[model samples]
Target: MKLLPLARQAEVTNGWLRERLRAVLPEVMRRARVDLWLVVAREYNEDPVLPSLLPAPMMGARRRTMLVFHAPEGGAFEALAIANAGVGLDGFYTPMWDKTMLAEAAEDQWACLRRVVAERNPKRIGVNVSAEIAFADGLSKSEHDALMAALGPELAARCVSAEEVVVGWLSRRLEGEIEAADGINALAHGLIAEAFSPRVVHPGVTTAVEVAWWLRERARSLGLGCWFQPSVSIQRRGEHLGDLGSSPDAVIRRGDLLHCDFGLHYLGLATDTQQNAYVRRLGESGPPAGMVAALAKAKWQQELLAAEMVIGRSGNEVLRAARAAMARAGLEGRIYTHPIGYHGHGAGPMIGRYDNQEGLPGAGELRLQDATLFSFEMFVEHALPEWDGQRIKLATEQCVAFRGGEVHFLGGRQTAWHLI
Candidate 1:
């Protein structure tokens, strides 16, 4: 597949930004009971939502850039960028402060912000502050102090945390974004397939670290970026490398069961996938029956988890339902699925965690929404009769989206092992 040119990618991203600003922002603000949302950030420390809102190629927030979004009772909300007029944001935002205005004002950006607030007189002012979601907690100490001082006690009294607004905006995936994500995910899957093949991995000569670096280089060659370092691990007959035991220096060997945790970032969207492969020894035609059966159990677990992704249901609720279904099927496994989009572990509901499978408190309570994507990550533990009754864990993570009242894999899930 051909990668989008840098210029083309920027055009597509800016188009999506326009759609998001016009359609998504107002609804999200209203849902969170926010009349006015204030997002303030400095040069290097930008609010997570700010980057998503800005036009592409504008690397970071420039010199105390402040974005104020005011949603009225109806109609399009006001989008004002409290920065220089030459920043090329005229198409999307009205520049509230020019260089001349800043030079004449006592407290430039703050004064502009205050004037806007006074003019609008919004009932509820939402600022980025939260203990629940890190993506929503973008307000820095100095920025918060500046905002409070500018608004004074009376106006500050109306201030509320914009956690819901932030999550809602970040979690909701547009149709165009979902289409672009599908292409990016297909590229990622192909890269992983190539990395796990004999062209890159030689049983005794290549180490896990070598393969990992190859994957990284492959991404760079295709003008793509990885959200996390690619990990390669082997689980042999007697050696159980546990979850964290996949060392970079471990040498690949014949008859080893290989696993990889990989992700790719492209066009501002992210993809997370975990897949397994088996190396064929001298005369072996295929994997043993026990190994094949273990993978089938993992596939069944994937189906069970996907079935519980009901729209409007909380992640915790989905987790409960999935666990009960798995129990009914007599399957032993753990589910740790999370939203994947803007960030690899993007905004929205978190179904479960590896260590904390019971439920996540604040994040897990978030309800699922249509048009959002998730990383269906989980593992199944079963005893393999072919390996002298040794128990092994078959783990899988694939990108899937909830749309039209059903869950669909971006690219189909890995059913067969990637044979090496």
Candidate 2:
């Protein structure tokens, strides 16, 4: 899994950003009924959505950078960048505060923003302020007040929360991006396979913590970033099934079931995967029949969830439908799936929370749109006859993309355990 050099990575990201702005912005604005959208961020305190909008090389916002998107219904779309100096965004955004165009250096950036809005006179002015999604609520209190003062009363009256456009723009994935995610997910899967093998884990010698750190170090060795710490847990024969597996220091042993929750960040996309491994005891060919059956049930739960991920269905609606199906199958499970991309728990509809299986509140109410990526994360419990009918939770997670009204697993899912 070779990564592109920093310069090449920047080129690829900038290209993707350009395509997104040109192809997705206008339609998203129209769908949200927003004629104008403003994204404001300062140098250190930048908006969550700002990095996604920025070029790859530009790590953070310059001194008080503001992005303006003017996309009216049945009209031309304009992307404007208001900053004190050039931020290498010439082709992507039309510069609003270019030094050459200025009559004097004393002009304020906010004043330029006011002038731009006055000329456009858009009916609906969308701002990055929301009570629901944090990704859409990027505008700071001071910035909001200053914007209101700059726009004055009448223009400020048209201000509205840009949740719809923000979510739509952030969640939507292009064909190129989806393709990249497929490869990124494969890299993560490969790393997990290597870590679960005898080369890294030795029965009775390697502790769960050792394997977890190995995963983290392996990712860094491959030049990959991890959004969260890698976790490894053990489920031995006499342990409680629902105890979230054994502690981090639990040692690997023959006939023990191993589980890991790992994620890697690469190419501006994140891949989250939870997989299971079984240590083969002497003279045993594979896992016990009961353990195998439990794994099968876990796969079935994944299918049930996938079946309900229909286009335009709200996250809560999907969760309800999937749970009903699971109940009909008589399987006990919990699902806490989420959209994944730039951020690990990326911006989009949140299906269910582990603690609250019924549904989430604000994010769950959002509908699942096409061209989005999600992590199929969940667990199912089943009794193992080999362990005297002790119930064990078999958790599995894999990256998937929903496009063209269909669900495509980024890399093929784990149907069988990685035997160590």
Candidate 3:
């Protein structure tokens, strides 16, 4: 797969950051009903949402970075940055600090922030403080104390948690970001394809760990990075599911079922994917009928879940409806889907977890909105007749975008198994 140079990638990413600030931030602030949003972070102690807002080529926050967004009633929106001088953020945010004034004993950083807030006099002053979402809970104890002190009680009384604003900004994807993710997801799938093929796997000769490392190395070669370690495991006849795929030394053999879970990030977007493969034995042109049927069952389950992913529905609501549909179809499976973006397990509502299929609390209760991305992750196990009633588990995952009331897979999902 072809990839752009590092400098070119940075250029593209910085462009998207500017677009997101110009077009997306105001609408998201309106949706969350926040008039003033303040994001405070010290150098090296960056907030989760801070990196998303930073321009490319900048990895950490500068000394005492204070990002202020003001969209007061019937006034023009503003994105202001109050950091030390020459921070290189002036291109994106309107700089509100003057180092020269501090030398003359005019005003401090906190005093400048107070002046900005007083001038805006917004009805709802939003700060990064929340009990539910980690992305929104960025303000540290010391910073919070200082911020409250600087606000001088009157403005402090108007402070509210900016959880909704954080969620809105992080979850919402732009056309360019989504389009970049398509190629990134395809790169992930291509790496998996190569690792599962005979080019890397040698049946009884290659160990599962070797293949896993091969995947990791291949992603690195393409200038991409994995958010989690790539994992590969095996299942064979006469073995219980619990006893399979645990050992790092398990060697791949003919007639074995192989599974892998891998995730990679590039250009500020991430993808989480899980797929399986089948190793053909002697005198076998393909996998057995039972195995084929099991894969088809998984496909149907994916369809069931996709049809229920509508706009304005909570993640729990979608999970419940999908589970009911799966039961009616007599299928046994688990769904643990999540949003994917700047972070691997990105923000937004979580459909379900592996252990808890009933529903999730807090994050799961959040509703789904448009222009968001998700990893439609799930698995179905079938008792195969070819394996003497032993069950085979098949897991499928693909990155998808929810826009205009529909889910579009970034890279097309795996419909057929990778045969080695």
State the lDDT of candidate 3 residue by residue for 1-420, as single tens digits.
Answer: 888898998899999989998888888888788999999999878789999998868777887899999876667889998887666686989988776424532578999999999988888988999898889999998999999999999999999999888988999999989888888888889888999899999988998889988988999887889988888878889854333234367778999998888999888898888888999998898889998899999889888999999898999999999999999999998888998898988889999998899998878999999999999999998999999988877888889989888988887788888899
Clashing pairs in 1: none
Per-candidate TM-scores read 0.97, 0.96, 0.96
- RMSD of each candidate relative to the true structure: 1.6, 1.9, 1.8
Question: How far in Å is the alpha carbon of 332 misplaced in model 1?
Answer: 0.9
Question: Roughly what TM-score does model 2 have, to 2 decimal places?
Answer: 0.96
* Residue runs of model 1 more than 4 Å from their true location after superposition: 100-107, 242-245
lDDT per residue as tens, model 2, 115-227: 99999999999999999899999999999999999999999999999999999998999999999999889889999999999999999899988998999999999788899
Candidate with better lDDT, 2 vs 3: 2
Q: Compared with the true structure, what per-residue lDDT tens digits does model 1 show for residues 1-420?
A: 588899999999999999999888899899888999999999888888788888987877877788999997875699988886666677889878766423554457788889889889889999999999999999999899999999888889999999999999998989989888887888889998998899998999998878888988999998989988888877888986555425458788988888888899999999998898888888988888888999999999999998888989999999999999999999998999999988999999999999887888999999998889999999999897877888777888999878987988887668788888
After superposition, which runs of candidate 2 have C-alpha atoms over 4 Å from their true positions?
Answer: 99-106, 240-247
| Model 2 score (lDDT) | 0.89
